[model samples]
Target: MPLRLPPLPALRFFEAAGRHQSFKLAAAELNVTPSAISHGIVGLEQALGVELFAREPRGISLTASGADYLSYVSEAFSLIAIGTQRLPNHRADRPIALSCAPTFASRWLLPRLAGFRARWPNVNVSVDTSHRQVGFPVDGFDFAVRMSRAPVAGTAWTRLFGERFVPVCSPAYLANLRDEQGNADLRRATLIHVNAASEDWQAWFDATGTEGIDTAAGLRVDTIQLAFEAAAMGLGVALGRRPLVDRDIDNGTLVQACAATIASTTAYWLVSAENADRRPELFDFKRWLVSEAEHFDTHANPADQALQSTAN
Candidate 1:
């Protein structure tokens, strides 16, 4: 009825030491000082009422009792990792849970989701829009679509798409820029930025080779949709993704300020842990997802920037 478990710090210390066979090595792995690891192991040994290791001149070695205990500890940890990874997809029989950025969800995935439902009629789906970097086994999500220049550590990464962003604004904002120079106009206008990627403005500047741009002069939001909405409402100009704002550009809701476009270092990444991918349901969900991604790509051109003159 009661959960009887050793203190987490002690167990963690023991697990690290056992795996590495050295307090020093474990300490390095865990980002703690060697003295801290030694102290933690000492505490763990007292709690367990047994000697876990033999200190040698060269390094540490596990005692017989320690070796036996380690096997159980290792297995327990493996199971814990498995359980944690499964939690997000725990409702596998129900809705397939997917985590993504709010703007990416709203502008891209949300509109395209109906096709997934229609195709995979038996498989239910749920979407969570968040910018937090959630650990695979800890967050209880089946898979996540993250915006990153490269693969995130400790996860399998699938490249979804490379986004090309161009400066977009409401017609009213462009009217203000009517008299300003090409590069100077953008600098004069209120610039809208997404906070999630700090290098976004810099990368755009580098790609466009547009010098003398000040990134500090504008409003920053975490989600791209918010930035787009702000730009659409005549709040400011935003670097807008072509795929996400295709409909808006078509309908003349947003206008491109310059003919120049830059490729974003941030890309849509489909990610899941190795253990999580082992589940059959996860494979099923992934297969369906790949299909949906292909479908969206078919209609959306990766290249093709329509100017305001043509859009209107």
Candidate 2:
């Protein structure tokens, strides 16, 4: 008996399109036209007797079954890649490829990476800050740091730490918001909002029972880093995520706007490949990352906790 398989070219197109979720993007990556991708996908689906993608006005999305199939396909491809790299002629160097959100990389990871480099001088590491959702080994990343409320399936997830959202502003700006009672009042303050966490303001208001402020009206920015920068610039009171703001508050760049903190529902997590036990570098990095997180939690600013309450 022979092993049954679909056309290799058809599977290639499905893999690329599945990874990107866009025929146009997949076509560009493969140096072909969108129509070619579409045709290839159609043929593959017909042969399998199942629709792999849901075509819509905005873009395409993988069907539930298709998504499940993709994981297996991607794993197979990754095995081939890994085997090829192990060939005698292949380069001896294999860097630990890491994928993480931009803000996380800048504010938290970058500051501590020097220590990792110092410890493992011989091990090379590469960081990618793309905002795209990675497809595991298909994306060539050994590990990823993502923020999520619940662990997503199909990958190994390691819980990091949760962030508390608190309103922070320049000391000068905070002084202006002080009421006659000398307590900071947000009733008349300009709220700075990070679009990624647009609901932070509402959630903060709800959780803390803070009244009389409009959560919708504010200076809008795309990223948490930008929102923090705006708050530091005295533009307005922006909700700041912990650890990210710890340095700013310590340096007097920003201060607590009010004493009512709300914990974010999402926690930072490290996702890794299922077969990561084979990679010693990944294990070493994971251990170091977890240790740093624990140390951070143990030594969280006790003084600031009392002063920093309330959020975006």
Candidate 3:
């Protein structure tokens, strides 16, 4: 008996669409047109006799069935990828596949990636950024860097460093917040929030024993990068997560909004499968990563040092 299954292309479309919930993004990732992605998924729905997505004016969302189907489909693809990677003829020089958090990837890792390339000229790194905690070899990633409060229960995991959250904004904006005594007055300031629902502002407030300022009133953005950008434009104060915000603060794109600093509950970690020993490149990459983190300088900017000194 022949097994019933959607076309390979259709399945690929469905998987990508389900993961991103955006036909345009899925199409871009697959190097195809958005219409092609939409049509392929439509053909897939017709084959399966089930609606996989609810199309909305702003965007699309996976249906309950689609969500369930996505799990199995994703797992099947992961297995296939793992098998392909294990093939004897697999190239020795395949790029390192790394899964990392989106914000960290864009703000911290991408900036330092050049340094890594400089050290290991022959080695290549392919980064896939997501907030998802993807599995080890099953997900076809050689390794991953994730943010967490505790170590992963069972994996080759190591702590990188903790982050300090400080409010930051453009220097011109900071000048306005300075009071007669040179201390910041946040009561009249606008807050730039990463997410409306997140406790970023509230946590900072609690840590600093701050009150009287309205944390609920703020410009909300989906990503930390956007938050920093908004703050840089003198729009409002952003809860700047250090390491991620270091470069911006260093370059004078942003300034310390206030002297108060709060340590983050979560820190970045490097996680890999125990069997990663099979890849010598993984070892070298990990060593390079550890060294980079160990020596990361957060206080190099002269202007920034002067500002912090005054604020203190």
In candidate 2, clashing pairs total 5
Tens-place lDDT per residue, model 2, 147-172, is 89989998999888888878899999
TM-score to native of every candidate shown: 0.68, 0.82, 0.74
- Consecutive 10-residue window with the lowest summed lDDT within model 3: 297-306
| Model 3 whole-model lDDT (C-alpha atoms) | 0.81
Between candidates 1 and 3, the one scoring higher on TM-score is 3
Q: How well is each residue in 1-312 modelled by candidate 3, as lDDT tens digits? A: 998878998998888888888898788777899999999999999989999999999999999999999989987887777677778858778888889867788877888899889888999999997555455565567888877788867578878777778899999999999999997788878999887324498998997788888877979998888899999999989999877888898899998877767667877888976556677787888888877777664432343446455545
Best by lDDT: 2
Per-prediction CA RMSD (Å):
9.2, 3.7, 4.9
Query: By TM-score, who's the top model here?
Result: 2
lDDT of 2: 0.83
How much does candidate 3 score in TM-score? 0.74
The candidate, 2 or 3, that scores higher on lDDT is: 2
**In candidate 3, which residue pairs clash?**
none
